[model samples]
Target: MGLRWAVREPQLGDVRSLVEAELACFEDPWPPPFFISEILAEGRFNRVLVEPAGALVAYLFCAWQFLDLHVLKVAALPVRRRQGLGRTLMELAERHARESGGESLTLEVRPGNLAAIALYEGLGYDRVGRRPRYYANGDDAVIMTKRISG
Candidate 1:
């Protein structure tokens, strides 16, 4: 999955919508247990963006790995694509990473996903490496990283 920025803490009620959004955005979706687990994963910093009516708009599920914040899954709901949500999320993620004493923000995306790649590049994340056959569909993953300034 590639996408999201969060404004709300996910609730048990938000899991199904998050799952649905994940299913909607990704060809190979993660199982519900991951979303379920996040509801109580206090040590983690993942978050969801929800509408005032409680609809899930997007989410950022990331893990702090050593000195870097690694974005595991990020996606906006299909209807909410563009309009700067991805940029907001990435900018916020970078800020959070820096505040948490991180040196970089990192993520992986499909090489064919030019829109997402463009977004990452526009945000200063440079392609640094590649993981061959990274997706279930056998697509190679392009690794991108942005160094955070204090």
Candidate 2:
């Protein structure tokens, strides 16, 4: 079988699976109810990339307002990391944001996450600012933004 993946709005049923994937990738994963709340909230966007067998392999969450798309979270399963899944999910978000008249997509990543910095940089995101003590352990966050003109 060949690899296949697609991004779609996350379902309530996928929260547990997404949390599992998040746990695999992060030392601090959001609780299941948090994902549920995002999915149920207005002006928020949450999507998941399902594998060939319908497993949740990756997820991206963002909050939209006016011309801004603020990416709140994203993660891929350990087995899917470095396999282009994250890039694909981000591209999907960019396309959606542009189509929705978003002027820019913004995100903050932990300063120590070199892999994520490289991924965002490679995808045309520039480091625009920083937030000190942004992460749970007081790690600084490198703010990045990619303009996707409407």
Candidate 3:
């Protein structure tokens, strides 16, 4: 049988695993301190998908700003990609945002990240704008937003 995975709200103890996953997934990943701060910050919703053995395979970080929820970061371990964990994390983030009274959810993705762009688009996100040179490596960012409905 295939391994079963579960998603839950992240705790302080999961910071290390989350950071490790981030490093494995991103070329310019956020440092461990950033994960720590985001997980501990007020108005932030952090979720993690864990394997049966308690290894974190995916994570999503988002923050509620007034009526808007901003997706700060999301990633799945390389071995766990294309298995719907990213979609699951995004769904959880949307639900949390809606429950928090958010009217919309916004995120920025690199123009070169076709997989992420396709995922957001498939989830009903629309491209709203672009930010030039948004990344440290001079990649432009594509800004997308999805409305939250009751």
When summed lDDT is taken over every stretch of 10 residues in candidate 1, the lowest stretch is: 1-10
Model 1: colliding residue pairs: 3-74, 3-75
The alpha-carbon deviation from the true structure for residue 62 of candidate 3, after best TM-score superposition, in angstroms, is 0.2
List, residue by residue over 26-82, the lDDT tens digit for candidate 3.
989889888878878998888888889899999899988788999999898999889
Among all candidates shown, the one with the greatest lDDT: 3
In TM-score terms, candidate 3 sits at 0.93
Span of 10 residues, lowest total lDDT, candidate 2: 1-10
TM-scores of the candidates are: 0.90, 0.93, 0.93
All predictions: root-mean-square deviation over Cα? 3.8, 1.9, 2.0
Better of 1 and 3 by TM-score: 3
Judged by whole-model lDDT over C-alpha atoms, candidate 2 comes out at: 0.87
lDDT of 3 at 81: 88
What lDDT score belongs to each candidate, Candidate 1 first? 0.81, 0.87, 0.88
Error of 2 at 50 (Å): 1.0
